[model samples]
Target: MRRKILLLDTGREWGGGTNSMLELLKRIDRQKFAVTCCFYNNYSRGNSETIESILNSIGIPVIFIPQRRQPMWAKLSKELLRTLFFFNRSLKKEMIARVDEIWRVLPNAKAISSIMRAGQYNALYMNNQPSTNVEGYCAVNNLDVALIQHCRIEPQLNAALVKRVNERVDAVIAVSHGVNQSLRQSGVDAQRCFTVSNAIDIHQTLPDRAEVRERLGYAPETFIFGSIGSLITRKANHHIFQALGQFKRAHPEAKWKMVVVGSGPEQEKLAQLAGTEMIESHIVFTGFQNNPLDYLAAFDVFILASRSEGLPRVVLEAMLVKTAVIGSNVVGTAELINHNETGLIFEYGDIDRLSGYLMTLWQDATLRQRLIEAAELRVREQYAIENYVSGVEMILEKCIERRTHV
Candidate 1:
């Protein structure tokens, strides 16, 4: 008989981790594992229930765990508090505030317990940010079910909460080796952890870039550099603009333009930065794009300048598109890009080196083409969706085995 698995996302929203979960849910072998997603807050932004819609299309049923919908007043109150707290300690600090989290969590705990009692699940998979969020609260009482915490970020703080949750979770599935190492250092059992990189749907990604670019108002000759992700401070988009400024200055004759995809609080700052300098004219902020692959196709180079990462899915997407990449040399990024091989890598905070790499790639068509070809080969061979799903299945099987044995 197939083992039953339940995936949980509290206050459901499809961020990067949840996005990866959606892909996993769609591809897991139904015959070997009965997977049911239990997400609360049907009205949440990014709609965790959309996973259900996608699942139902494939004849899979998802179980929804309902909670007392917070009234607009309470939500506003919490938002007002969070805003004030953020002004004081920042989002990361507020997240690790376990004492302040108690009052907000009772409802979530009740909801998760209700779902666990409703189903006979062999394993419960908690997507990223699980340790200090709703999952951490729900995990308070349950000690029997196998738990998998899909960690996607390196929490610089929260050592105590992470340690507490790590002690209880059955496994920690780090999205990258760097994340796994970080977890181990935080006292998660090294033997009980695994690294499973974020992946792209190989089939969905096989589109013709030339046609897509032409449709997006870019000629075939336009040398476009693109970056995807929310315009958040951690994403360090300003650094990219700084690097681009220098690249344009050095290679004045190069027909290069940049496309900044996605929207966030930093959009205006980026726009203002771009406007003050003549280089801003060469920079186009495409705002928020749902289908960024189209923009990726129009690009000769893709860059990620995050202060940190958990093997960003965009990096894989770019590689799949045969787009040469330049990534910040931090944590999980090094595992994905081999400097001067698959793609270029620069020291995390070095803008001059970044600009140099950008100019060199833009100037040398042979080198750029070589990296693109190599990246495409790597994606097809090692980073396919099939491989990712299979690895996850194996992890689930082992968890089930351990659960049954215990």
Candidate 2:
């Protein structure tokens, strides 16, 4: 029969990775693989709740791990070490004690038991990285579910924890070649790691330009520039504002206006900085829109200024919408943009160079037209939903075939 899979995620909020997971989950063949989700409630946020609602609506059963919701020692220790960390410090305990506490408290045990009790799953799929939340259960528990880890981010803080988790999981999924390269450097087994680039929902993203422009109040002549993502330091949007400000000063009568969509902790600060510039009115912060593609459709150029990334969905979406893009030549971006062909790429955090490129794209209609045409063709051929679904299905099938052999 069908090989069953249980998905585990300890992260409480739904970010780009979760969005990718949702997209991949929707495409998995139900007849070949039964899917279930296990998550931690203690770290729960509105985004996680929203994701759960979406999954349930699609008839996916989400198993909430209550023990993970309340880690008694971690709660007590946080109060005890409040002065030491100043919000950063952790215990000076031995590795055994720390790993033990982590193992005891996380709901991985409960999750495994639930899976065993239900008596269905032959494999476990854990999304995102270095989650000790499921490691304890998978490593020691009786059920021999083939474990899979989907590594989504460029791990910064939890190297040791991620190392332990990687040691236990059967397979690892890196979202892009860049991420896979880093995972190899971090000692993740090369044989187990798979690079699966993020894909786009063309129907949701590839909107009619005229209609989207009309909805966003953009004039037919307006050269709209856009960026979508959180207003955080990693995004480096302030630099975009600064670059655009310089460009506006250079061309005082340009018809360009930028729409900064999505909100985060950096909103007020970025707003204050943007207000100090001549192009403040030119930059509109739409906060977070559920339908961001409508905004993408209105854009002549799309930009990303992130310092780090595992393959952003926005770039794929922008390319799919036929919007010419300019992004920082950071990790995953290099794989997507080809300098002058599909789009332009600049050195990460280089505002002057970025400003120059933005100016060139704004002034040169031929270059903009060329990049847009190439990008549309490339996205249609390389990043379709069918390709994404098929790749994931092949992996799931491999897991199933292995299970059958056993």
Candidate 3:
């Protein structure tokens, strides 16, 4: 019999994690396992429901848990309770806060859990980051079912939470070695964890560079630098403009333009910094592209300056499109790029070094082509979707085998 798996997600929007999960849901061997996905009906933004829709279309039923549709009173009450918990040092108040959370979440968790039990799900898989979301309580409380979690971020090194997740979940899958290292550093058992890199679906046909440049109002000769990510502080978008500013000042005669894609709360701050750096004219901000991959061909070099990441899907996409990628030497980014080989990596906070690398890649066409060729080869061999899904399947099968035997 095909084992039934209950998958849960608490994300409010689409991202690398959600996109990767969508790929897995679509490709996992249905003959070996059946999947039912449950997602919170939270304030999901553009294309956030892409996964839910795809899952439904593939004969996989998606159920939205109505836990996010809280009443105004309940919302206010929780805020007040959290505020009270923050200020009160008393043990009684902490206990009260715990009681309050349990009171609010238990009934809903019970409802979700009841559905899982009725369905006879062999395992509960969590994508709604276990440490922050309350969606797992119901499933975790059911001792008969296997609980598995995919930890995709370098969570703040919380020993207790790490220990709890390790103890409860039958398996914990990390998206990269960086995340796995993080879990182990936090005292999670290495034996219980696995590392799986996110895979990307490469678009077979790309628009000609000349055509793309013309439509976007760029000259064919103009050197294009592209950075696609949320314009948030953690993304360190300001660093892109900062590094470009220095790079531009040194290469005054070079005809170049940078396209900044994606939007967030830090838009105005980034705009101000662009102006302050006097590189505003050379920068183009395309906010919140639903299909950022469509614009990848226009970039000679792609940049990822995030303060952190979990095997970013964009870097892979950029490489597949044959664009030279330069990434900040942070967790997942560092793991993706081999300095001066597949791609270039610079110290996270060092704008000057980034500028230097950017200039070197930008000036040397032969080197850029070499890096792009190398990156595309490496990504296809190592980060393809089939390998990723197979890895997931192996882990699920192992977990099921262990649970049934015990």
Candidate 4:
């Protein structure tokens, strides 16, 4: 009989961890596993094309906990607090976080736990580390169900929450080794942590790159570069624009452009910066792609300039499509880029250095091909979707086994 699993996500809107859940739901063997997903509708930005809709189409019943979306003022206020946490990873953030949890998160957890307790699931999977994680942990406590935390990002929560998660969760699945390390630093036991790099459905077909570029009105022969991420401070997507501004000043006649393939809070400021730099025509922001990887083939070089990351799925997708890659030397990114072997690496905020790397990749076809081929080979060999599914399958079984023994 298939083991029934209940999956929960923190955000109403979709992000990498939600996308990862979609990927897993699409590929997991139904004969061995059955999944039902739960998300907060109150906080979610409802769209026709969404992870919830996609899951529903695939026969997974989605349960929406009607959460009132936090008002814009409250959201911004929380982000301000988080920004302070980001700039200074201090101990006091724990107190602030504990307050957030006590007032905001625990109430939501109690609400969700009521719905979850009535469900017929054998295990609970926390799809993210933010809001729903606490809910999942609280929901599954004393329920005799397996609690598996599939952490895709670093520790951004309070120490109290981490301690609670550490005590409650039976297994910790880290998307990258960097995320695994971050969890440990935040008090997760090393024995509970396992690294499972994000993978793509390699066999899935994508839109033809040439066709996509033509449809978007790009000149066929122009060299194009792109990155897919949120326009947030942590992503440092603004740096890509700054680097491109430098690239344009150095090579004004070059027939190259950039594509930013996600939307976030910093779009307005980034757009204004583009206008100021006179490179507005050199950049395109395609908001919220349903299958952004389909257009990966359109990029000659794909880069991520994030100050922080959890094994970027887009990096793997870019490699799968054979786009030459560049990443910042952060934990998740550095684990994949072997310093000019798999792909190039750059310092987090060095626009000039990033601009130089971009120029080098654009200028030399030999080097570009070398990096692309190596990246593609590495992904195919180590990070195929089938292997990832198998790894997850094993983890699920282990969690079940642990529950039985307990």
Compared to the true structure, candidate 2 yields what TM-score?
A: 0.85
Give residue 297's error in model 1 in angstroms: 1.9
lDDT tens digits, residue span 208-278, model 1: 88888777888777789889888889989888888888877777887867899877889999988877555
TM-score of each: 0.86, 0.85, 0.88, 0.89
Can you write out model 3's per-residue Cα lDDT over 259-318, one digit (the tens) per residue? 988878899998899999999899898887776766787899999988888888899989
RMSD of each: 3.9, 3.9, 3.3, 3.6
- Candidate 4, clashing residue pairs? 12-44, 42-67, 42-69
For residue 21, give model 3's deviation from the true position in Å. 0.9
Worst 10 residues of 4 by lDDT: 41-50
| Ten contiguous residues with the weakest lDDT in model 2 | 87-96
Reference-based TM-score, model 1: 0.86
Q: In model 4, state the lDDT of residue 56.
A: 71
Q: After superposition, how far is residue 365 of candidate 4 from its true place, in Å?
A: 1.2
Tell me the deviation in Å of residue 353 in model 3. 1.6
- If both were scored by TM-score, which would come out higher, candidate 2 or candidate 3? 3
Writing each residue's lDDT as its tens digit, candidate 4 over 1-406 gives 8888888776745677766777788888999888888777523332456666687789998887765645566556666777767767564465456666665677777876676677767788888763346767776666888888887876676566677776878788998888888888877778888888888777777678778788878897789989887778888877888888888999998998788888889999999999988899988888767668666888989989988888888888888888889899897888888888889999899888999998999899999888888988888888888877788889998898789799
Residue 308, candidate 1: how far off, in angstroms?
Answer: 1.1
